[model samples]
Every structure is written in C-alpha cells, then in structure tokens.
Target chain A: MTFRSTLAALALAAGFAAPALALDAGTYKVGFVTDNTGPLAFAGTSFTRGAELAAEQISGGGYMAVGAKIELVQKEGAGDAARSIQSYNQLIADRNVIATACCILSPIAGAIKPIALNNKVPLVIYGATAPGLPSLPFVYSVTGLPGPAEVAMSKHIAEVAKPKTVAYFVLSDNEAFQGRFKASQAAMEAAGAKTLGVVSVLSADTDFTAAATQAIALKPDLMMVYTTQSPAAGIIAAVRARGWAGLMSANDAISPLAVFKKIGPPLAGVPFPVNFSADASETPKAKGFIEAYTAKFGAAPDLYSAQGYTAIWLIAQGLKSLPGKPSREALATALNKITELEHDVYGGLPMTNGQAGTRYTLFLNWTPDGKIAAWKP
Target chain B: MDLFLAQLLNGCALGALYGLFGIGFGLVFATMGILNAAQGAYASWAAIIAMYAIELAGLPFPLAALAGIAAGGAVAVLVDQLGFEPLRRFGPGNHQAAMLGALITSIAFWIMLDSAAGLMTGQQSLAFPPGSYPATVFQIGPLLLPAMQAVSLLALAVVGGGMHWLNTRTRFGAAMRAVGWDPVAAALGGVNSRVIVVATAGLAGGISGLAGILAGISTANISAGLGQGLMLKGFAAVVVGGYDDIRGTAIAGLLLGVLEVFCAQYLSSSWRDAFAYALLLGFLMLRPRGLFGGGGFTRA
Candidate 1:
C-alpha cells in the first residue's frame, strides 16, 4: 500500500477505536476537524489526544446516557482557511454529525464559523483564541485567548518590576497574539506605563533577531511577547542575547516543555498566563486529568489538549442533558444553556457570546528545568 | 550606530542560515535537474533524529548533530533510489513530462516524510538540551554575536567555500556537471552518472540537515513541517540567484536576509514580508539569469 493509504488506514482505525457497544443508548456522532499536518500540527495532535481521552472517559464513566456511545468523526483541516471549510463541510454533510469541534488556529475557526452557521451544525471551537470571535447562535469557543490572563500576568509583573515603560513584540498577522499584546499593554498602561514601541513579524517568521533588536532599542522597562511557541522561543533567545533583560513575559504558547528546552535556563521565572496547566491543583478533576493525560500521552497535557478535552467534555455534557435521543438542534440548545461548568482543564468554562470566562489559575512561571509550575508571585 | 551594528551582525547571522539552507536547494536543482521538494522533509527528518539522539541517547551536541546530518544523507539516497529513479526510468516519455513526474514524486515523498516526522515527533516540537550548546556572547568592539549565530556564520563560510571548491576544482564536481548536463552521454563516457546523482543528492540532504539542526538550535523552528518556511525562503533565493549557481544563491540568500531585517527595522515590520516579495519580483524582472548569470547548468 502507498504511504498515503497507510496513513488513511491508521487514521480511520484510530478515529473508530471505540466500538459502539452501548446496549440501548443511541450513538451520538460528533465531528472533530483537525489541523494535524502543518506548522500548527502540535496543537492538532495534542488536541486529538485530549479528545480521545475525553471520549474514552465519556464511555467508561457513563457521562452520556446509559449505553450511549459517542462516535468521533475526524477530518483533516490541514490548518488552512480554505481546507478547514472543506473539512467542516464534509463533517456536516454526512453521517448524522450532531456537532463539530474545530481548529486550534483562530483564523481557521473564523473562516469555518460562517459555514457552520449556514449548515446549522453546532461548531465547538476547540482552540482558536483570537480576540473578539463573536460567539454566534450556533458557534461556541472552548479556548479563549490569554487576554484576561495576560492582564493578570501584567499585574503580577507589575508587583515585581513596576516598569514605567513597555515595548511589544508580536506576531503581527496573528490576531490572537495581537489581542494578547493589547491586553498586556492596557494593564501596563493602567499601572502608569507608557507604550515604548511595537515590533512585529508574521506568524511564520523565524528570524526574530531584527525584531528583537528594534524592540529593545526602545529600552522599555518591560517586554511583553505574544506569539506562538516557535516564535516565542526565538524571540526570548534573541532578546536575552541582546541583554534587554529588565523583565520579560510571554503568553502561554511557550508553555510547552519542548520550547523551554530550546530557550534553556533563560526561561527561568518568565510569567505567562494560559488556559490550562498540568500543575495539579486543589481541583480533583484537574489532578485526574494530569494523571490520565500523562499516563496516556507520556507527557503532561498542555493548553491545546486541554481545549480539545474540554471541547469534547462540553459536547458530551450538552448531549447528556437532553431528555430524548440527541438531535443537532437540541445539542445546540444544550450547549448554549451551559453558561458555565467545572472543568479539569480550566476551572469554570463553557460557551458564551464572547470570551468563555475561565479560571485564571494557569498564570504560570517557568521552572529552570524547563517544566512549569503555578506561579507563586 | 551601535544598534545598527548589532542588527547588521544579527542580519548576517540570520542570512548565513538562509544561505546555507538555500544552497542545498540550489545544489539539488543544479545536479539533478529537478527540485527536490522533499528537501524540507529531509531537513526535518535530520533534525528530529538529532533531537532524539540528544534527548534519548544523551548524545552531546556535535555528535548528535553529525548523526542527524549523516542520516539526512542516507535518507536522501534512499529517496533517490526509490522515488526519483523509478520516475526517471518508467514515468513519462518526454523530458519535461519526466521532470514533472519526478517533481510530483518528490512532493509525494515530502508528504511521506512529513507523516514519518509527525509520528517520530508525536507532532510536537523538540529542542536540543538546554545546555547542549553554550550560549556564549562573543563581542567585537560594538558588535555582539551569540555562540549559536557565531557557529552558524562559521558554518556558512565553510559550506559556501567548500561547495565552491567542490563545484569548481574537484573530480566529483565534474561528474556532477556531466550527470546534470546529459546523463546518457555521461554514462557512455564511463562517468557513472547514477553514482554522481546519488552522491550529489546525499550532499544536498546533508546540507539541508545542517540547516535544519541549526534552525532548531538557534530559532527552535523544529517540527514536522518545520522546513516549509525554509523551503519558501530557499526557493526564493534560488529563483533570484539563478537555480544552478550555488555561490550566487548563497550571496543572494544573505542579501535577502539583510534586506528583510533592514526593511523590518527601518520601515514597517508588519509589511516586511511584502517588501522581501517585492525585492524577489524586482530581481526576477531585472536579472532573470540571476546575479552571477549562467555558464549553463553544469558549470556550477
């Protein structure tokens, strides 16, 4: 068989790992559109694992109706705007798919939102944190941007640095990162800091030295970086290499341990807010998630996986709430009615019109050893 | 002035990487007469292997990197034998059709490599151990170069110089030129054109492997599709520098890298990508044969 066929076979087998053996419960078919191939593959892969874990939990824990099995139909989004729509359409058109959780990139979610609305297939956004993604009638967001947490992070940094000026390094094309910059900036300015300047690069940009030099040239007392993990690692190294080390913070995109391994001990004590942390808290569900995720994936769950797990968990819970056999419209109504829920990933999160308000406990600091712990300061 | 100097040094450092990355693409195009679309995948494979060696086997920096580079060459050879050779032999009747067939095969191989990398990496980015390489700062008057950048610059010099020597002064270079020009005639003359093509592919893969590892260490752009941006930037350099001219490609890569930095710093960082694209378009219109022009494809 060709490599393509082999991969397709593997995907088909993996997606259908849970056999529908539920005696009396109607099989609830849900769809997951993933960007599992390109630069954003990290999120897609992790999110899928999270969804798998949750799907297993729903079956074993009887989170759904008795003998009610949840079938996850996954389509490859390929992490592009055009491809996401095609994938979403495939999910919506066939197989009685009640709802679809899609995308780790916000831009893609935005692109597919209109299509989902037109099809009236409830779209549960797994991880697109772009700011101001309007939660429409049929659309819901599980992963909100780190804006609120960035504000909290700014407050935390203010307690330590109290910088009077701030400079920004951002992924200019990424609305999510830009939202983070804006939030961090607002909080800093509220603390009496002035904007120094902003230097930007595209999301795919690798060379951060030039942008870093320009940002540091402004000599801001504090530097706030808001980009994905790869750029976050590069910019951190670049800025530190140039000795702009008054105080630095970044969003949770850099929370991955692999990224910390590259940036090295330079990441020590850098504060960032995220939506999920494997740092076991007083919350039992979170502790269970950490253990389960680590046991299955061999690594602690990060933000993307948490978003994926929560997306599924939310969908399952919504499906469970309905009295009769689950339908698409009922599932949509069930999802919207759930304004809040206690989740393992984020403390209190469900879908809303704008930001799905979540627990800010993921405000994190990097341990020198490239692992993360809940920030004390 | 100090900041300008710093940016200049940084630009040079980045350009060195870009040049090293692009030169491999130029080498494959020059020797094989086809774009190795899988060039990025080979880079990624090498990087993942290197990272695995470091993280799992506890190999030190240089040894682990060498292992990855060598693996890259081996993988390239395998692809050449399995993917490209079949296309050349049984694909199509015409030259253009065969070339296109080979290109499509490379792309298929690229996807295949990406899937393999995705599986190996668990679709997560891996990095060298934090202290695997020291981040020492080397200062020159007003300029500062970090250890990573310094090492990459050094690599570019050796690579660019070595490729130049190999292309102009070696028997292997002659074989490669002969093979690239007319494989049938070269075979008639006992040049062992197949061996030349395979060796050239191996060398190209090794260079891209170096580029991948360097990128991982310096920028941490290490992932399944990590080489996509490199492929784009490298292809741009190749197009602007003349596809067959390695030295010209390297120089063009550096120039593009510096121009990107200057535009981002002095002008608008938001539209910096557009500026580089505009430069690429201008080069295409003004100097279609590239800066060095051409002495045909074989004169590399």
Candidate 2:
C-alpha cells in the first residue's frame, strides 16, 4: 500500500476502536447558547469562558471518566432571539446536541425553552433567573434566581435598618428585574417602608438627569435601584451629581465590577448579595475552579464565570450517571433523577425539584481601592 | 413649584442634547434626501475614541473631545465614500431604486459601525476619566444643573447656531442647498456636487459626534450598543421637527426630550414613553408638517 493509504487506514481503525472505560465515552456535544456580543456581553463572555474551562478539565480527567470526552457546541447571540432559535434548531439537526445550556438574558431563555422541551433535550439554564422554571419536565437551572436574595435584602432593610421612605429607578423593559422590584417592595412595605416613587428607565436611556431631578424631588430617605450595570452607573452618578445622598441600594444587576469601574469612588462601600464571589471562594471546589479558571483565562472568574463552570459540571454529573449508551433521552432521565451533585462550583449543590438556584451564602462589597471583599453586613 | 422648575431645567438640558444630535440626522435627510442611520454610530465611535484620547493619549478633556469630533467627521466621510457615494453615482438606473439602495446601504453601514466599535472596545463599557466633568453645579435656589449638562447646553447653542448661519448665509451652504435641490443642475452651475455631498456627510457626523460626547459625559455609561437607541430617537426628532428643515428638527428634538421628562414626572413613570408618543401623535395630527415645519395642517 502507498504511505498515504496506510496513514488513512490507521486513522479509520483508531476512529472505530472503542476501548477505554465502560462509561459514556467519546465526543459528546453540549450546546451552549449565550449573549456573547451585546450590551450584557460581560455575562456571556464570563459564562462561556468558565464553561470552556470546565469542558477542558472534563475532557482531561478533571471530573468525569478520563475518556468521557465532551465537545462544547458554542453559539452566541447579539440580542436576537430569532437567531438563537434558528441556531438551536440547526445545532440539534446537524450536531445532535445532546443537552443545552442557554442564556444570560431571561428573554432569550423564554424564546428557546419550548424548543428544547419539545425536542426532549435536557435544558440547563444558566442566567435567566425567573422563578420556578424547573417545574417543566426538561428544564433545570444551574444559576440562582434573584428571588431569595431580593427578598432577604428587603427584609434586612426593613427589620435591621428600616428607612421611612424609598424611591426606585427600574429598567422598564426587563420583566425579571421589574419582578425583582416587586419582591423587594412587598417585603419593605409590609414593614411600613412607604414607597416615594418609581422612575422607570429603558436600557437606551443615557441621561438620568431628568429621572434624577424627579427622584430627588421626592426627597426619599432611601434610593432603591434595579438596573443593569450601565444604567446603574448612570442612575447612581446622576443622583449623586444632583447632591441627593441619603442612602442607595441595588440588586445583583449592579453587582458586576464593570459598574464600579464606570462610576468610580461614588459610594463603593455598598454591600450586595451575589451567587458567588472570588474573594469568598473557600470551598475546595471553588478554590480549584478559581485556580483552573485563572490559569486558563489569565484572570480570576467572576459570578457569571462561576455560573457557567458550575452549570457545565452539573451537566457532566448527568452524563456520568448514564449507565448505558448516551442519548438525549437518557441524559434527561439522569438529570431529572439527580438530587445531589458533587464539587459544583456551588460546593455540593443541593437540587430541589431538579432546580439548582442559590449559591453558597456570600455578600460582596467594593473596597475604596476597588477590590471586592466579603461583606460582613 | 421648585420641583417643577428642577424638572424643567433637567428636561431642557436633555432636550438640548437630543436636539443637537437631531441636527446631524436631519441635516443629511434634509439636504441629501438620504436617511443616514449611521449618525448614532458616528456618536458612539466619537465617545469611544474620546475615552481613549483621554486615557491613552493623555490629552486634556476638551482637546480629546475635539479630536474625537474630528474623527467622527472623518469616519462619516469614509462611510459616505464606501456606502452612499457608489449608489448615488451608479445605482439601479432609477432615482427611486437608487434612493432605496442608499437607504439599505446606510442601514448596513449603521450595523457595521456598531459592530466595529464593539470589536474595538471588546464590547466593554468605557467611562471617561473621574474628573472629566466639573464638580460645580449650576443651581438657582431649588433648581440645579450639573456643570456637565450646563456645558452641553452651551455647546448645542454654539454648534446649532453656527450650523444655521452656514446653511443660510455662506456660499458653501448655498452650493449645498443647490445640490440638495438638483445635483445635476448644481453641477451645471459650477458647484462640485460630489464634494458638497462629502462635506455634508462630515458636518452631519461632526454634529453627531458632539452630541454623543455630551451624552456620554452626563452619566459616564458609554457603550457602542447605545448607538441604535439614539438613532431611533434622532429619527423621531427629525420627523417631528420637519424632515427638510434643520432648525425645526432641532426644536422638535428639544420638545420631544422635554415632553418625555414632563410625562415621566407628572404622569406614570412606567407609562411615560407611551404618553409622550400619544401626545406627539395627537400634535402631528394637528400639524402634519411637524412642530415648526413649512406649512400647517389644512382640510381641503
């Protein structure tokens, strides 16, 4: 035989040969859909990087069986849900994506959830944090919804340091954060914290001066805000610029470091609860994740990255539990039956009704020097 | 009453910025009959470049802003050269078809500019330096305006007034108008029509760049994604002010901004946008030519 023919014959033989372990081994595709290039690009980039690292470690014997190789079928969105639906269908048809990890935005998840469920592919949602979505047969969440933390924060203000009057600046279009506002308001008002007013803002709003003027006119004791990082930075700056400084608070939407960078030295000491923080990564799993993540990405992982890393590991646990040949149907069964997952970036995540939300209890605050630290309050 | 005054001042400042941006959006459409969607992109690129000019180049804030505005004009001319110039010169052999082709090309350029800015900045939100705005507040008793906003209002007056004068009184402006009326006739009249087109593109871009910098300076939450949003509002300003009149377009933008603030203040905040649109729609029904257009609405 010619040398080229001999090489081709050897490659074909190696491809067909199945030795290794009696586990679900050899190239498996996990479809990951994220908003990698848009307004919330930070979330998508961080999540996908962590997932990529998790895939690398799993493929290199970090978690599951060494030979249980996984291929991440990555897809990105630029705030287009139609494109996401199209990509999901394409990936399922061509690549046979066994399971899917989807979305940083709740809107995108709302769009693609029906497709995965109808296809019987186990969908692990990473970012969209609306409540009780895991009630669906094929749906599970690896990231915590903001409900628990929002409720707790509201109660903390009312019971611990109740302010008499409060005003809010909310993202008008985000149904999730708007719901977050209601959850927070119910707790605060139940204890008699009268709401002064609500100033609705769109993601497009650049000037919060008018909104600031209106909010200051109310002269509330506490200024409650629920907006993503960009608008959060804008609102805070506007209010501060207008010389209204009673008290200010916000949800995890404003917790990213980018917010702090945008509005430097303006009340950086405000503490907020988040799912995970690099400073509070004490568990063996979290420590390993930080080390591995930093080594791979050349930077420590943030909350979004932690979400992606833990979520992929959660999917890996399902893959490991499959006793026979791996199929989307079998993986769904394994994940549905999974109540316990070890070494979740959440540190042994306790799944309740196939939903894993609420990471280890950790609150983070920005120091005057702009470093993140554990918040005692 | 004090709260009302505060809202008025705040709205006026914001309205001024919106009006300034609308000048560019309407400038191109009024003169060239081409709705330039990339006007917001010019602004986004200006802000991004200004951020770098401040941080990387170590230039003082005003000089950096000027540099950024200059870059905006340069980019606008380049876009015209690539996207619109070709279509205007050699299109589908009909005026309507060429106009449609140019519109599509402008929209494409708009998306391309947004993507290019996003790529250059790694889709990250970049803010100006900490002391970019003065800490001084322009206050009159209960009414207050930040120094940044005060500066923005002043800029709009100078730039807007200068543009009006140039368009009405200057020879170049007259040539631009002649070109707008009929490019072939203007060329026959010894006006270099293509040069006039390029110059108009630069002016529109510079105006947008100035508006973008002013908007970015206000809250320091600058992002490339902000372009499309601003473009929509700019279009609204153009339509409401009168499509073919720059001064009316500017005033209409101001009115829209003020109306939005008042709606949010007096009406329900969540329903403010709906309220503003409803009011504008009613006004437009009465005055179809817009707030200060050439003719009033009339029934035959």
Candidate 3:
C-alpha cells in the first residue's frame, strides 16, 4: 500500500478502538474555556488548574453523587471569542458537560453567556468584569463589575492624591475596556476632577514615549492608565523616564506581578485592585487554600488561580444542594441562590441579581523591594 | 517652550532609533530588490534571545546584547539560505514571480518565527532585566533628555558613520555595491554575488537587532510583535528617503519621528500615525524619486 493508504488504515484502526476506551457512563463532566496556551496561558492555565484542583478534591473525597465522579473537561481558548465559543459547544455537544466555567476575557464570556442560557447550562465567569454580563440569568459572575471598580478607583484617587485635574490614558482596543474607560472618565469628572485630556492607545502599541510626554506636560495630579500589560509597562516607564512623579493608578489590568517586574522601580506606589493576594491569609479558609495550593502546584496562587478555585467551589456548592442528579436549571438556580458565603480562596462573597459575587476588590501597591502589598483605600 | 524643546529632542532621539531600524529594511531592499518582511521577526527574535541570555543563561547585559545581535545576523543568513536563495535560483524567471515568491515566503517565515517565539516565551512580553540601563536624565538649559536618548542618537551616529565608511572606504563594500548594481555582471567580474547578498542581509539584521535592544530599553518591555510596527515605520523611512541612500534614509527617519511627536503633541495622539502615513503618501505622490533620488527597484 501507498503511504496515504497505510496512514488511513492506521487511523481507521484507532477510530475503531476509540469506543473501547470511552469514559464511564456515570461520569459527570464540568467544562472550562480560557486561554490555556499562547500569551495569556499563564492566567488561563492557572484558572483551569484551580478548577481542576477543586474538582479532583471533591470527586476523590466523595463530595458528589455516590459512585459518580466529576471529570474536568478544559478547552484552550487562547483569548479568542470564536475559539471560546467553539470550546463551549464542544463541551456541550461532545462531552455533555453540565456546567461551563472560567472565561476571563469579556468578549469571550459575553459571546458564550447567551449560548449557555440557551443550552440551559450554567457559566461561571471568573475574570471578565463587563457591566453587561450579570443581566443574563444562566451566567454567574465570580468577579466585580468594572463600573464599581472604576467608581472606587476614581474616589480613591480623589481621596489620596487629591488632584483637581486628572488625565486618562486608556487602551481602546476592545469594547469591554472602552466601557471601563467611559465609566472612569465619568466617575473622575463626577468626583470634581477636571479632565486634562483622554488619550487612547492600542493594546499592541510598543512605544508610549509620545503619549507619556504629552500627559506629563499636562501635569495632572494623577494619570489614570487603563492599559493592558505590555503597553502599561511601556507607558509607565516612559512617564517615569520623563520625571513625572504624580500618582498613576489603573484597573485590575495592571495588577499582574509581570507588570511589576517589567516596569521595576517605576511600578512602586502604583495601586490597583486584585481579586486575591498571596499574602492575604487573613481568613482560615484563605490560609487553607494557600497551603493546599502551594502543596499541589509548588507555587502560590495568583488572582486567576483564586478566581478559578472559587468558580469551581461555587458550582460544587450548587451540586451539593441537589438531593439527586442535578438538572441544568436546578444547578443554575442553586448558583444564583449562592449569597453571603466564604470560599476556599476568595473569602466572603455575596451573590445577587444574575451576578453571583460582591466586589471583593482589594487594592494593592507595588513595594520598593519589587513585591506587592495590600493598600488601604 | 521648554516642553516643546524637550519633545523635539525626544523626537530626534526617537527618529534616530527609527532610522537605525529602517537601515535593515533599506539595506536588504537595496541589495535584493525585495522587501524582507521577516526583518521584523528577526528584530523580535533578537530581543527575545537577548532576554533569555540575560534572564536564563545569566550573562551580563552588554554581552547579552552582542549575543542578540549575533543571533539576528545568524537567523537572517539562515532565512536567506533556506527560503530566498532557492527561489532566486529556481523560481519563475519573471521578476514579478520572483518578487511575489520572496514576499510570500518571507511572510510565511515570519509567521513561523512568531509561532516559534510564542512557544518559547509563552507569549509573555518580558521586561528587560533590572538595572539593564541607568535611568538618568541630563538637563541642558531647559531641555530634559533621558541618558538613553543621547545613547540612542550616539549609537545611530556610530552606525551611520560605520556604514558610510564601509561603503566608501572598504573593498567588501565595493564588491557589494557592484552586486547591487548588477549581480550577474558582478558574478562575471569574479565577485561572488551570493556572499555579498548574504553579507548585506547579516549586516542589516545585526543593525535591526541593535534597534530591538534599544527599543526594549526605551519601552522597558519587549514582545514578539513589537518589531512589526517599527518595521512598517522603518520601511516608510526607506521609501521616503530614496531607497538606496543610507544617509537620506537616516534623515528621513529622523524627520518622521519629529513629525510624529509634533502631531501627537499639537493634535490628538490618535492622529499621529495618520499624519506620519499622510507624509509618506505625499512623498510617494509628489516626490516618487524620494528625497535623495537613489535607484530602488527600477535600477535593480
């Protein structure tokens, strides 16, 4: 036989043998779609692993229906909406997963939320904080809305820096960020802060020297940077290079430890809210999570990890309330009813409306020693 | 006035770096009559390789930079040999086919390089190692210029001066020029055209690698796609300066940088790129021969 025929024969053999290795009929599948590979892999993988760790513990320790263990089915979206949608469909159609969780990107989550509602499956959003998300019933957000954070951030700037004038440097590459930018501008103006100007930069922009110079010349009390990681570093570096000593604050986009290491000393004193802090072992549950996460993963959990871990627990809470095999509607209702609870990682969350969590946004500042610490508002 | 002056000097410094980057694009085009799109990929790779050398291999900053430059040159030579050389030898005899083939092949190679880089760096835009460059600003009268700005300009001057000396004073430059003039004729004249082509590519890649490092220092972060925009700006400089004229290319790059900052300063920052490209379009329309009027594709 020719090479093509030989390869086809081998593939046919594997296809024939596939059903013999199929999963058990009683296996309950839970799906997760996020950036598991590519630039966003660090966050995506952390989220997936967080959910996986919880599922493993629950299934192994018999927290679910007797004789039925949960299998975590993860799809790598890589921050693309189409890919995320594809993964969501695969989870429903191929794996018959009861629930889907952990979409970090606003666009991807926004796209898949409607699908989850239509399919009668519950979606737990971890990272995306878009204001429009909570209105959908089947979708439960484990994160704060960007509107609250923007309001909080503006008020914090007004309270601390007390700048009469503030300039905004926002990344306008997506609708989600644009919403946050508009909300911030409105909040800053409402707080009696005069706008020097609003400057927009592409997330992929490599040079922010010009933008930095322009903003510096304005000499605002604070320069609000709502930019993604790489551009945030560049803008911050350029601003500091030009000797602009004014306070710089951002949304959660700037909270990553990678940003701290990249911008180095310039990052010190810059405050942003984080969903989780490794140093935050204030609650016993948080302490348990830190210890367990370190033991399991060989490193401390990040914000994504905490969000991911909490997302799975939220689903498990819904699952545990059911006396029998939980239907999609029942599970979503249970998730919707989750209010005023403590999680293994994220402590004291309140679920309401279609949204499932209170704003647990903790402000953190980069220290001079290249570490991040909790900052009081 | 001080603000304007500061921005002006900043523009000049930025322009110098742009010109430094533009040289790689210009040099390859001047020699090969093809725009090597993989030039940006080489530049990105150089930054990444340099970062790895420092962050992972524990090499000192300066040595890491040299390693980066060497890597750029080596990768460029490899691309030429593996991708372009065979096309030059056996691609369609038509010029259009040859040009299109090279362009498509270079773009494909760039995609492959990007994928490979993504895999290696986990798509992370890494910061330069701490203390990579001292953040000191020098004030002359009212102008506040970062020390990195001066270094950028001085480096560009050295690069331009070295290139000028190489072209005007060296035997290799003479053979290289001959090949650019007429490769077949140069081959008949006992000069190995292949060596000249590969050498020019290596030299261009080395310069681009330097640009990448400087960009990392200036921006304080480096990503795989960082070079794409810079590559476009550099190509615009090459086109605006009269393609084969190195001095003209440098001058045009400086002009573009200054113009971009002025636009961003006076007008909206969003209009900056629009105004720069408008200038490019104006040049292509009004002064098709470019500012210095050196032969580009036609002569080649």
Q: Identify the candidate with maximal lDDT.
A: 1
* Separate clash counts for every candidate: 0, 0, 1
DockQ of each: 0.45, 0.57, 0.44
lDDT of 3 by residue, A25-59 (tens): 35677888868665566467677777777787767
Write down the lDDT of every candidate, Cα atoms only. 0.79, 0.78, 0.78
**What would the per-residue lDDT of candidate 3 be over residues B58-126, giving only the tens digit for each residue?**
888889989999988898999999999999899998888788899999999888887777776666777
- What's the distance in Å from true for residue A214, model 2? 2.0
Candidate 2 on A164-253: residue-level lDDT in tens?
898988888888888899888888899899998898888666778888888888889788888776777788878888887667777665
Candidate 1 TM-score versus the reference: 0.90
Query: Global CA lDDT of candidate 2, please?
Result: 0.78
Predicted model with the maximum TM-score:
2
TM-score of chain B of each: 0.95, 0.93, 0.96
What lDDT is obtained when candidate 1 is compared to the true structure?
0.79
Q: What is the iRMS for every candidate structure?
A: 1.9, 1.7, 2.4
lDDT, ranked from best to worst: 1, 2, 3
Pairs clashing within candidate 3 = A351-A356
